[model samples]
Target: MGVCFSTEIKDKSSFHTGVDTDGNDHSTNSSKVSSVPPTPRSEGEILQSLNLKSFSFSDLKTSTRNFRPDSVLGEGGFGSVFKGWIDEQSFAATKPGTGMVIAVKKLNQESFQGHREWLAEVNYLGQFSHPNLVQLIGYCLEDEQRLLVYEFMPRGSLENHLFRRGSYFQPLSWSLRLKAALGAAKGLAFLHSAKTKVIYRDFKTSNVLLDSNYNAKLSDFGLAKDGPIGDKSHVSTRVMGTYGYTAPEYLATGHLTSKSDVYSFGVVLLEMISGQRAIDKNRQFGKHSLVEWAKPYMAHKRKVLRVIDSRLEGQYTLEAAHAVANISYRCLSIEPRFRPSMAEVVKELEKLQEPKETRPRRHSSHGTRTRRLSSGGLAAADDAGLGAYPRPQASLPSK
Candidate 1:
């Protein structure tokens, strides 16, 4: 992780201006689109509602400039995502076919996520409407092609900020970091606090996209599922998700639950604090895995200073670091009951900023304000690296 201050100094002004107390943004549309709120439905029920012909392939290809190399936004197990435009033939927006940027996720012919996963995305991103969740504009399923469209996220993924190395990892200011955490927590809270719990099976830095203002939106619903209930213990399924972030218990057994998400979130919080990936080649033996390495240190705040990223220096509050670290430790607890709900996580994260009431009566943080990281930087190499990070508090793995 090499998010260098030296490289980003030229763009520092852009970063500072993002944290305004003014909730009013010049670009935001005050006019709300009135529509009947989607009726509540389980994941399966929502999946059934995706209408195939709503988005034509011709429109998608045209909007994406025939999936031009430059139009590419991101990629995943699903497929390449391209920046696309609105046709307005179907929805008839004011913009019509011009200047309207949307992200088009075209599914690979033979993707690991498969058809069930596509349905899952349609189900969640389709029905859910929250500021913190990526807005799924629509999708296209014509013959073999399966494409998903989402609102364009200007700043790219959270992974780009936390662990991508060089300028990408350039230390985020304490304020922006807290803001990102709060936004992500709000999205997860919206998911888990619903009458039905939806487990985000794949919650990692790469899936958390940022707009121009550094606000986070949770994406990648292909792996999400309804979390366990009753004494059901865990929802069993084939193991999936990125390495270095999967929960130990779920990895050991197919059994999954809402707490699995909590564990993944703990890993994410650790990444934010340390400015390091969970596992990087730079780490010494026994310290390579962030979960195993940091457990003991997080349990004791006296060692907290050792775990925080050196790049931060005096920028962050030590007390704030300890508070968030402790919360992460609990989130990663072996027992599901010990883990806090997403709503609780959101509340704790909100406390990191200040009292919600403290903002000026008029200008509050409402719409997004993103600061772009400088694009070019060294991704990784053998570590000439930062020193040690401590372990989280000792706790037994659940049976």
Candidate 2:
């Protein structure tokens, strides 16, 4: 596991000054394009450096049926994502579903903030490839238009399946939820375990997309940053992420490490268990923060069951829930030092996949109960690495 520090440092000026009280960032469009000098390489050179496919705007337009509204898959601050089609071999435009399906994300030309994010997505996804990570097929930058094309994730974002309410939504079963969690962990583990570790600063349910077979893939590299190198323990950067999922330490101080991603993973795991948003304004005042509200219950064996999603009442085995909750608790330790690395997390979760008869021996924790948790639980590891972590002083955002 990575090291951590809890010393209270002087607060820095707000890096997200352009962000509104509601957490919406307005800086993307405020700055002029020419204000910031271009890098040494030209735009074309930059794309070439990544060895990425640069598609003509005309090609993408035809693929998306001329950007018809009916083809839209999802829309956000960046722009709308359209369901499109292209030839599998030559990448030519094709009739919808008659050839390879693609998701074309067109950026809103007016939003300057999205340009940097768009380039970051292209550069990173273009350079890295993993089964658990979303695949960027190509990009189009023509005139005032900026866009990205990716392999279509037929099932869409995990956020929709986890929180969106409607008849179209079918609650994910226990096995499926575990599979998604494990896949996402592997994605993060791969990034953190890379030669030059990459910190996925933004880790949330919405960033996890699903394929037709229910396989999970991590998407969106807009806020990802390179980890600290040499002797440096952490990297200092401007705060950026969704309201509820940001780590308390990272939120208080701009210092970031791999543990920050672990903290975010814990929040998403909590969401999977309780079927609740990290921060929901609709919830009562004290109950608005899922992590805060769920913590008390998670500490107790009987009460922990209360936090499980009501939809999954009879679906999962009692032992599996206990194991998952234990992992979440460790990942969410207030002190980063106590949190296990993504690799360790993968091992613990894999144990849950084994049949009951072949499972590891049960172990006792803090005299709470004798729970069988993958040979030995993370609770023991925390005992060896625990450190003090000051509680965050910032009031939780209602959004």
Candidate 3:
């Protein structure tokens, strides 16, 4: 389910009252108009000031072919995504397969998300422009209708690659997985380090959209919020995010920080490594909880291999596998402060792409013998160092 917020305009005529959101009447008084107009603050004013293209219900209907069932790309709690076509330059309605493809998300009027969440999505996506982030083209807000239009992503979402079953789905290779991880990490890092600092409260495989070449972009910014600034430790917000992906601290205390997003990324990383959903009830009794069940194996040098996905068929090297699990382990630290920053995580992921011959190895500080790396980057199980794994200074306090 989506978060609920009230911000809809009840009367369309109230928007064109010639009064800015600040209650300053700009309309002419006795045939005399003001020389300068006030800045826009309301949804209508903000949309006009942004110069964002506004589509009428009729225009979108023509573009989406009246929301045909076959055009549906996917559906979620928010609403259904439909495939549509638009003129390349003008963004006008075009015949199917004749122009640039677009994805139209028609909000479910009965869904938990209302105008507030919808406006948040537009406000964020309309302003931010990054290669790792999905592009928002325009929006339609005719009467009660709320629709978002975006550039078409051909390959769909990372969730389909990681969890979807059947002949139509293919398991992501180690190289592709690493690529997706790196791309997603870059996107999150961008958000956290932006001038205004955005916290992607929702980070999961499904929000990671894939292009034709397997490039990943972050989508769905409805749950995103401005992060804390100077002198502020965290932002207090109502607990909202997907189950299993939310950070423990954020879930418990409603105090959100960038580290909260790091924890969510860790969950996604774990999913990538183990080929399991964050929460699955279909697994064996004790193993249903991916994070809880994988923690022990992740900490055990000899048993770490057991947590890896069987579908991979030993495609990855021993050292690389341990390194990934180590990263995941650090990210999943119970203490939020113990988790590495997104920038640090990105650097570590990037290092994994180095040639095996040039990869560095460290000896255990406890004097445990180090294993020599094979040509395939495999190391002896006994040589693994669980002691080298970083841990929090003390046990975390409960909510």
TM-score per candidate, chains pooled:
0.74, 0.79, 0.77
Q: In candidate 3, what are the lDDT values of residues 1-399, reduced to their tens digit?
A: 121111111111000111232435445321112111211121423354454677877878889899987676655455667778899899899998889888887887864424555777777788878999988888998878999888887666676566745443236766678788989999999998947488888788777877766778998776677887779999876555656777888867778899999999999999998889888778899977689989888966658878887666445666777888888888889899999999999999998875647644433333443443232221121122110111111111212
**lDDT string, candidate 2, 279-308, tens digits:** 887899999899998888786667788788
Off by over 4 Å in 2: 1-49, 167-169, 354-399
Better of 1 and 2 by lDDT: 2
For candidate 1, what is the total of clashing residue pairs? 16
Q: lDDT per model, in order?
A: 0.61, 0.69, 0.68
- lDDT (tens digit, per residue) of candidate 1 on 1-399: 001111111110000001111222222221111111122332333455544335778878777778876655444334566666674456322232486667777776754324556667777778778899988888777898877777777666666555544532354655566778889888888888747578887677766776766788888776677766766766765555556777877767757777788888888988888877777657888888887888889977658766776655554455777888898889888777888977899889887785435532221122333333222221221121211111111111112
lDDT, model 1, position 359: 30
What's model 1's lDDT at 331? 85
lDDT leader: 2
- Cα shift from native, residue 399, model 2 (Å): 17
* Model 2 TM: 0.79
After TM-score superposition, the amount by which residue 237's alpha carbon in candidate 3 deviates from its true location, in angstroms, is 0.8
* Model 3: residues with Cα > 4 Å off, grouped in runs: 1-51, 167-169, 354-399
Give the better candidate number (1 or 3) by lDDT. Answer: 3
Worst 10 contiguous positions by lDDT, candidate 2: 1-10
Q: How many residue pairs clash in each candidate at the backbone level?
A: 16, 2, 0
